[model samples]
Target chain A: MATTTVRLPRVLEPAVGAVREVTVSGATVQEALADLCAQHPTLTVRLFDEAGELRRHVLCIHNAQATRLTQPEPLADGDELAILPAVSGGSGDGRFEHRR
Target chain B: MTTLAVGTDKGAWLLHSDDQRSWAVDGPLFPGWGVTAFGRAADGTYLAATGSGWFGPGVHRSPDLHAWDQVAAGPAFGDSGPRLEQIWTFTTSLDGRVFCGVAEAGVFVSDDHGVTWEPLRAFNGHPTRAAWQPGAGGMCAHRVLLDGDRMWVAASAIGVFRSDDAGATFVPRNDGVEGAVPDGEPGIGYCVHAVVADPANADVIWRQDHKGVYRTDDGGDSWERIERGLPAGFGFPIARDDASGALFVVPLAADENRVPVDGRFAAWRSLDGGDSWSVAGKGWPDEPTYTSVLRGAIATDGDGGVYLGSTGGELWATADAGDTWQRLPGRYPRIATVALV
Candidate 1:
């Protein structure tokens, strides 16, 4: 098993005790995310849908490169995995604040 | 203490008052998420429904309204089923079963407070499932009302549904209501916005429809227009004060222009069980204030207290069941739902 770091955006920080980065061990991206969810069970719903697939609006990045969770790729120790939402913006009616 | 749990497009807030005269605000909890609905379990556990564009929908539980913990297993659909968009409303049954009304239009149930959930497939797969269409606000099951085995589920554009056998089956209850979509199936296209039933008699229910205001004494088998003093037939919310049996509605001009009639904002009240209506109370702004109240934005504390939040992010309260009003302090994101905790 490989130990890697997982990063999340601010919107998801609340589920992980307001922490942006977490460490887990897995051989592939899917396993790593599964491990992350096992530690913070609440993140399961936020990161994946009922079908056990990563939510379509969410993207997975590995070492600064876009990656798909479905296609399992071997992870190396100290590797970094980042989860981010798709870029979106529109006229604000004071309802939603755009965050980067 | 009187605390109003205010859910908004961005977060949730709790307004506390010792005597209902002076208020203190504490919130914006669950930051960056749309807190859509709030409810209390049979055991007094507070439940809040939250939705995110990227994270999907979830339910949070708390002993007090301030501290919340996300429930790992919330309401959800199957992999091939319609995507669960948002949790619109929650209704706790007499037997402690918690029912959740959700968008993409479906209902879910939780027996152990608000921790775990299972879809009510009978309602989700109603016989008219193929004919259900989205309203302007998206196809959403926004309200769930329960009276023993008789339950009502109201969805936008698709009208209201009644379940007589403990939710095992459901049928459309829009007999006397006008249809929103002309080409839709019989009894399936009525645009019902919100519904309030008589606490003493579940059959006697009031509805605020996209077409008009209506009431039914025969459990939705039929309906009659109740617009005697309403400015217009079109509006979004309908709330009832159980203590005084007073009914409330915020009438808008029409579906085409969803704003207060003539730029005036005031809640209309009917004292004789929705027979006749008039301006609810004093303290309404003298100047023109144009904004719409969402369906789930109005709530009653069951003891003469009524609270409402607006799309304009303002919160208003009535301690004496609409005899007078007071605007609470602080402006936040567009307010979506308010509950008396």
Candidate 2:
């Protein structure tokens, strides 16, 4: 069993209502994510693409360095992984709606 | 509901849209930096380039498309080399590699998502880095459109460059292009504003230069001028829809204005690739109000949505390939880059 810590941002910390950390397992990154999404069903659609595949845009980091989903990269015990979204240049006009 | 991640002067905003065009927004993330560029990866995540007005630049990411975090930060104006900097453009390849086009500097790639980065040394190392001159907006690496494994980047005065090895090295792609000759030479200046490869074809490509619109069927080896239907081919931005192979361009009515009829917006649509075109002003702005769309700011959402963000902070989107238009509310924060998220 591999144990890793996942972190959420402030905006999402609220949407998810409360900040909660969960554990997941598997040899591949996808397998680990599958377990995580299973525990936090709210993250299923955002964590994968239309085909339900994992992409780097989701920015899954294993132990500080980025992880390759295709490789047989294994997670270490007590290691930490981050599931981050790709942030691009954007702005908020006091006029439009702001969700998160 | 997919949110349209709009980068503007004030900050980063999310224009979220449901099935009925009922759009909502989230965040002006990084409150200070005016967002300049951003791209949502196939995995449905978003990456943003926060413009730090006078402070600096930084890159942020959100895996869930909602929450964002600053993974990396850039420099300020007097900071490209000696000072901090700003990221002019940000995009991700279908394969998920992140590329950021910076000012004064060149392209930077972050292979491990956006946690850390390595400058596209090949671009920053271009022999002409120092010699290359910035246009009206500074030497911002404009567009980094990825076609297959190859990548294309635009540098003002440095022209357009192609890297088949994925940002490793770059070579010029400016043959047969004309217009930006400084009123003398037959060649267009190295100031390329935007470039896009036909989503359906690897060989065909198009770019917007300071002088004229260009096309290349030989990867980036050679190009041809396609200025027959434009008031000025010396426009700044270009866009395309991968589904219909339909291309759309907004040429500034005047060489200097780049803001046709005084910012009265007009969209030029090319049907048979770039071989032919027709103008559509149904949803565009009217002239005399006087303004222009920014470089790399015109694009389609892949599902028939075409949008352009202007320096005026206006954002307009059309659902039917320019057939009709709808006005969204409000305006952009700063108006550097706009993308469908």
Candidate 3:
């Protein structure tokens, strides 16, 4: 089993013990995320969209390499994955911003 | 103990004030996330619905209103259907059940004091949803008014929906409400910004629509335009103090321009159930203003304690209906919603 360290965005710190670094075990990026979600169950809903797919705005970085939720490359032992959300404006104070 | 809970784009804060003149603030709890809605459960559990651009949406539960624990299994739309974007408003029923209105226009109920939630499928699967177009605020179920088995839900760009069987099934009740969409027309596409139900008489309901203000005496089966004594019609937030039978509304310029009416900031109130209105503008700044108060930003605590948060990040409190106002210290992120806990 490959042991990887995951980096989550600062915004997610409160849900995941306020830790910037989390050690997870997995051989692939998907597996690492599964382990990470297992460790922090509440993080599952935030990380995945309703289709059980990674949200379009979230970025999953694997050892300095960008990866998509649909297709994740293999991860090696001691790999570092960064999970962060795409930068965007606030959800509009309930007005002004157009909703999809 | 009157504690003002402010939900902002960045996080949530608690302002504890004994005299309503001075406040001791606490917060920024979910630091990087947006706090869309807040409420205190019937059991005294404080709940804040938070959403992150990166992490999605969840509920933060607190027993003492200070320290909170994020609950992961709050509400979800399975792996299909419309995505649950944000938790727009939270309503705690008289019996302690918590109901949360969410973006994508749906309702979820939590029996365990917001620890977990399940969708009200009947309302979500209503036939009108096919024609439910999103307003500028997205297709959000922003307001849920409950009175025993009868429940009413208001969504932006959608008219009021009523559920007589305890939210099991809902039917559109937009008889007198006007629609803003072209071919989309009336019924489902009518833009309703906010709604408040009379605590003394559940049959009486009021709405702040994109076009004008309306009141329904027969429980939303029909409505009557009640724009008397108002500067302009377009407004976002409308609330009422059940104890005193006083109604509150904030009128804006118009749909084309949503700033305060004529650059003045004031809340229009009606003591005799929307028959007429008077400006409750004491203690408010007379300077030209351009701020907008969102639908969920205005809340009434007990008899006449009115608390409002503006898009400009200012918190205003009025202890005596709107006779006078006091501004809370410090400016924070854009305010989305407010509640008295």
Interface RMSD of each: 6.3, 15.6, 3.9
On DockQ, the stronger of 2 and 3 is: 3
Candidate 3 whole-model C-alpha lDDT, 0 to 1: 0.82
Q: Candidates 1 and 2: which is better by TM-score?
A: 1
Query: Which candidate do you rate higher for DockQ, 1 or 3?
Result: 3
Docking class of 3: medium
User: Model 3, B1-341: lDDT tens per residue?
Assistant: 68788888887788888888888988867776788888888888888888776667778888887678889788877876887888888898889899898888888999998988999898887877787778776788888898999999988878789999999889888788777686674467888889988787888899999879999999999998998899888889999877677788888898788888778887888988898998875877778878888888888986779988887899888888877788887687888888887
The residue pairs that clash in candidate 1, if any, are none
Query: TM-score rank, highest first?
Result: 3, 1, 2
Candidate 1 error regions (>4 Å): A68-70, A89-100
Candidate 1's residue-wise lDDT over B1-341, tens digit each? 88888888787888889998899989778887788899999999999988777787789998987778899888888888887878888899889999999878899999999999999988998989888888777788888989888889998769999999989989999988888998789889888889998889999999999889999999999999999988898988999999999899999998888899998898999999888999998988788889878888999988889888888899888989999998989887888888887
State the fnat of model 2: 0.00
lDDT of each: 0.86, 0.64, 0.82
- Would you list the rank order by DockQ, best first? 3, 1, 2
TM-score of the first chain in candidate 2 relative to the native first chain: 0.68
Q: How many residue pairs clash in each candidate at the backbone level?
A: 0, 54, 2
Quick one: best DockQ, which candidate? 3
Each predicted complex: what DockQ?
Answer: 0.39, 0.02, 0.52
